[model samples]
Target: MSGPRTIWRSIATGLGALALLVCAASANTASAQAPPPDIGFDQNLGAQLPLDLKFQDENGETVELKSYFGKKPVVLMPVYYKCPMLCGLELNGLVRCLRGLNMSIGMTAEKDFEILTYSIDHREKPALATQKRRQYLAAYDCPAANDGWHFLTGDEESIKKLNEVIGFRTQYDEITGQYAHAAGLVVCTPDGMLSRYLYGVEFEPKDLRLAVVESSEGKVGGLSEHILLYCFRYDPASGKYGLAIMNFLRAGGVLTLLILGTAITMMLRKERGMMESHRLLEGSTHG
Candidate 1:
């Protein structure tokens, strides 16, 4: 049989080697799958808001980006109101998430934020905006309609400018008869500057709140800022926003294994030392 010291060393070495293998496997997988591009906000966050872009609302009233600034943070989405799949799903998700939030776009006595859904399809009519707004509003449980949401339609020039500024690349897929685009939400400061981009359909309410509050520069309250610290962030490799699952999981798993390995190593070392001490004492007594 191998000596106790050798056995202990072997066990420690085996565990360490196994842990390293697992880490290498994880790293390889991550490397093989690169993340999307970075579309997150920076110091020049809202400068891309096309101030000259003008779109008409459901009521046919012309609205400009400049008109929205300094009033309330805008949750702008570039979606064709007629989108058959992802667009509807995205809107539904936003509505569902917003319904659970305590803050109201218009009703919270402070006029905190507002929702604007801009139709990227220039051919989309104001009537379509009216219809979509009606459908979503009918389903919306919020009673404060006066200050909260607005569905808008605009001409091609306005749509193009707005889409370009927001980096919303949408294409008409004739084969599918649908717009091929990524699903996301963009938060703009009241001054019409882009602040945060929440990519994906289902977004956390806390993240939405922080984006609003931060864009407002703490002008709006009654919500916590903690969620923004750990919530969904932008990844540049994939060119779309998503939940930060890999980062969190990787960090958590590595730390856990490190702790377990350290404990096991210490225990094995202590056990081997005791065995050596016993052997030496016995030898000394006999001698």
Candidate 2:
């Protein structure tokens, strides 16, 4: 019995040590994959964009940031045009989402919106911006995209200021001559006030549409959109609009009451018509 008990104890100790080793290995791997301190987003919701900042359009024409604002909600993306990897993915994902939208860009009659994509690296020139713009516009395959989407390049100072206002932190890697940045986009109101920050390269078309509509402040979108906005509320943490259970219930209640009222009115009108017919018949019989 003593020999068996000793053997069991030794086996238990060995298993415990193995478990500890596995846990340590996992922890190290997680730490290695963690993003560096400088590469992340500090969401600054409702921050006012610096409209006076100047940037060169894809055509090399200098334009004020304000030029893009005050007309429609702007979806601003900060990315370097020459980026070999992540920037392309972000742009492709954005184009896919835009294609999913029922509305086109720059049509005031429909759900109007604008896309402003600027290079974070000042070293990138208008030529690169032009190349990217052409590439994406071709992929989007929307006639309005030529007017609604803009690609821009700016000097270092202006770019830095814009990034700071939006709380987009990035780190430059000297070893690779590349920048590390978190993936996201900012939606601003027509008046240049930052309204929402949507995170990640992949986004839902519904999410983008709602953000644009909310930022527009009833300037765009249709009646169904208004009802949707009423039923759903944006969650800043999730960076998405979720169904507001209470609001949905309230809307349901209101609709139910409206239907009942309409039905009752119709029934009353029918009864009145029948009574009038009976009275006329009785009068004719008595005559």
Tens digit of per-residue lDDT, candidate 1, span 1-287: 46998999999999999999999999999999946543332233556676767889888888886766677788887788878888898999887767656454332312668888888888888888889988888677566654478888888888877777777776666777777788887888887888888777886676676677777777776443434434455544432345668766776798899999999999999999999999999999999
**What tens-digit string does per-residue lDDT give for candidate 2 at 1-287?**
99999999999999999999999999999988946557777779888998999999999999999998877899999999888899899999988888777454333212387889999999999999999999998888777457888999999999999999999999988888899898889899999999988888887787887888888998787887788888888888878788999999998999999999999999999999999999999999999
Per-model TM-score, in order, reads: 0.62, 0.81
Off by over 4 Å in 1: 1-46, 103-110, 226-287
Candidate 2 yields a Cα-based lDDT of: 0.87
- Which prediction has the highest TM-score against the true structure? 2
Poorly placed runs, candidate 2 (over 4 Å): 1-35, 102-111
Clash list (residue pairs), candidate 2: none
Report the backbone clash tally of model 2: 0
